[model samples]
Target: MLEKYASFCYDQIGSYILDSLDYFEDIRPHLSKANIQVSLPEYVSAMVLSSMFVSITTLTVLGSILMIGSGIAGLIYGMILSLISGTLTLVGFYIYPSIIIKSRASKIRDTLPFATMYLSTLAGTGTSLPKLFKVLSEVDEYGEVAKEAERISRDIETFNMDTNEALKNAAERTPSEDFKNLMWGMNHTLTSGGSLRSFLRERSDTLMNDYRRRVEEFSETLSLLVEMYITVVIVGSIIFTSMSLVMTTFSPNMSTGFIVRLQVLSIFIGLPMISGMFIVLVGGLAPGGIR
Candidate 1:
């Protein structure tokens, strides 16, 4: 019996060690990969989980304590509230990561055109691909793209991975189709004796034209959006103000708190939202074109 127990313990320990090793290997590449710079914060993940549990537990405990004074009816209500709170907490944890990832993807998309333009310029100037990577790495002002390029350059120079492999690794890290396509074309050019400089220039031209068309579309849409908002705000304000005046005439003793609240809400909420919409519209229209 002792021998069987020892054998079982050894098997469990070995399995645990193997699983940990596999996890480490998977994360090891991701930590240093080129494309995506930020890792999901381990501390934040832990804190989020802990806080969620604490919140539910605290709410449950407080409700239970209060219910003890009210007997069976309060106990039932407290249990329902605890269940609702715990469910909501679980859903929040599930949704937050998805939202954050989507937001990050949008930011990455915004940066891609600029990175492509930078790369195209280097490619067009008769710089070899590896040298272009090195140049981008050295360029301090280019932000995340520069950092990503530098990682690729490092992988190539230190590990002797071919440009294609490094680029493939980068695409995997980023998980962006745009980056993947660019890397694919670049790798093909490097390996197949094709003219990379011309390919890059042509791609740059294509992307630039598409970007310009998008800007034009956004600009045209903005005028209509602005008109719509102005009409809504103006008409609503007029109607609401006239109704309030009529009400005041009818109910002279009534407190004007509702009107004041409406006015305050319109000024605080509508004005800021409208301004934000305008800024978004302008940003889309111009984009500063990647600079």
Candidate 2:
């Protein structure tokens, strides 16, 4: 449905949209890296159309509700909110490709060590390059790396691209720097008549070592984050709430309601926010492939 809408939007006014944009050219490479199937004009048009739809919906719903309760002032506030929502939606759409690229890169990095090990094993058996990739592509255990292998295989089989040409294209578009380097290395090794098996085996060892180091680093970081969460969120909140309660008992000038509100804020709002932040921190620090 969205694809159809995007296509229609592009067909109607794509040239005008493309002409008005300065950054769409810059975004083209990101689309390729992110593996987004849509053309640049289609994506931009979808973004515009989606943002417009959301803004209009927000305005109609919220503005009606507000106008019923607060008249013209409510309508004005609703309009402002709709505009903000529309702008944020547009910005989110614009940056979505970069987000996908980053995620794909992370997934590729996570799977690369194991994938390369498998590649090295296949190369040791004297399997042809095309057959090696085709086999890897069929294996779902490699995650994003498998998808990448599938693309390479497709290029060779379907697009009629030679190994070097396909590898060059894959290296250019791959989101992970490590994967890009690996592809380039493979291309060079093959072209120079070097031992592909030896190169892959060496690369596999290096990647495994790096992966181990990352996991170790994440273990240390996780311990620190655990300690911080305990001290700042749990123990600190208990102390703060207790102290506030005792203070309200002694100080008649301090409103009991205000003290209660503070306790509520600390226990309900602050605790959750701090805990959520710690969770996010731990997730970010944890190595991608440990599981």
Candidate 3:
């Protein structure tokens, strides 16, 4: 009886330790949330994506082997290594583009509202539309937008470019519709001699309202998504935990026991994370207009 009890205590302790390790593994990817920035060089970013592909391919193969209950063959298996290398090269191409798009979107989203405000204020100040942009470009208060605006301003000041040319350059650089429309409005006002201040004022108000509405909409959508995610995590945790219990009940020496366990680990543990990432991507891609 004492021996049985001792075995049960050891099993329980082992189970707890495994559970803790699993929990950490699940949250590890999201623990270091990277900020989207425009600092990295294109080539360096590509290299990083390549590295991620290589790493993920190796991990997948090792994981798949574990899942299939296949032990690696003797020293330096060429087939596995070659397969991983090919997989990495294939996957790396797609990963870099996705990362680049996401990063660009993040930076654009951050700079948008401020650019609207600056343009609005510049318009309201009775400066000519081109001069307004010039003033904005010179201002140091804004970060990325200021840098971009300064670039536009330089084209005007140094290149002696027309307002339309400079504005078009700005729009081309950012690839944001907000700036594109701003350029359009400036061009229209310049050509037609419309009230630039009124145009900017309307646009600024619209952008602010749209920004608020987008935030509200995203909050509502994300609240629902979060609820769904939590439900999935809970249900999945329960299911895998039940499976773990079942595994514990069965003979530990089964040929494919560890494989089954790892598959369970991937599904229950890895799936929530993959789901969360898709949710974040959806949120990023959701169509939102800045008035």
Candidate 4:
């Protein structure tokens, strides 16, 4: 359904969308690195169409509700909110490819050391480059590395590209700098009649060491995060609730209902929101495949 809508949007005004955006060409590499299958014009069209749809829907629903409640002032506020939402939606679509590229790079980096070790083993067995990638592509354990391998394998087998040419293309498009270097290294080794097995073994060792360092760094980060969680969410909530209860008890003029609502909001809403935010922060900071 989304594809059909995007296609329809593209067919209607894709040329105008493409011509209006000076940075459309600049995002091509990002799209390639992120492995987004849509063309630049189609993507821009989809962004424009989606933003318009969301803006119109928000305006109709929220404006009607607000208009009924607060007259013209509420309607004006609703329009402002709709505009903000539409702008944010447009910005989100614009940056989505970069986010995907970063995520893919992280996943690839996390899995590369083990995948390189596996490739070293295969290389030692005198397996050809295409065959090595084909085997890697079939292994689900490697995650994004496996998917990247599948692309390389497809380039060699299905596209009839030679190993060097395929590696070059992969290096050009890959989000991970380490993976790109590996491809280039392998290409050079093959061209120079050097030993593929030895090169891979050395590269694998380097990557493993880097991976261990990253894991140790994350361990330190995790400890700090745990301390923050306890301090800010647990202890802070308890202290705030205690203070609120004491104030309510001492101050006879304050509304008991208001105090009770404050306590409820702190416990039910604030604590959960803080905890959820912490969880998202930790997840984003942690290396891929660990959490």
Scored by lDDT, the top model is: 4
Which candidate model has the greater lDDT, 1 or 4? 4
Tens digit per residue, CA lDDT, model 2, 160-267: 999999999999999999999999999999999999999999999999999998898888888888888889977887788789978988999999999888888877
Query: Which wins on TM-score, candidate 1 or candidate 3?
Result: 1
Model 4, runs deviating above 4 Å: 1-5, 15-23, 62-84, 255-257
Candidate with maximal TM-score: 4
TM-score of 2: 0.86
Clashes of 4: 0
Give one digit per residue, the lDDT tens place, for model 4 in 86-172.
Answer: 999999988999999999999999999999999999999999999999999999999889989999999999999988999999999
**lDDT of candidates 1 onward, in order:** 0.64, 0.90, 0.59, 0.91
List runs of model 1 lying over 4 Å from the truth.
1-101, 138-144, 250-265, 268-291
Q: What lDDT tens digits, residue by residue, belong to model 1 across residues 81-195? A: 7667766664654455445444434444556676677888877778877888899878766555566678789889999998889988777765346656777888878789988
TM-score of 3: 0.53
Candidate numbers sorted by lDDT from highest down: 4, 2, 1, 3
TM-score of each: 0.67, 0.86, 0.53, 0.87
Per-residue lDDT, model 1, residue 123, is 75
Clash pairs of candidate 1? none
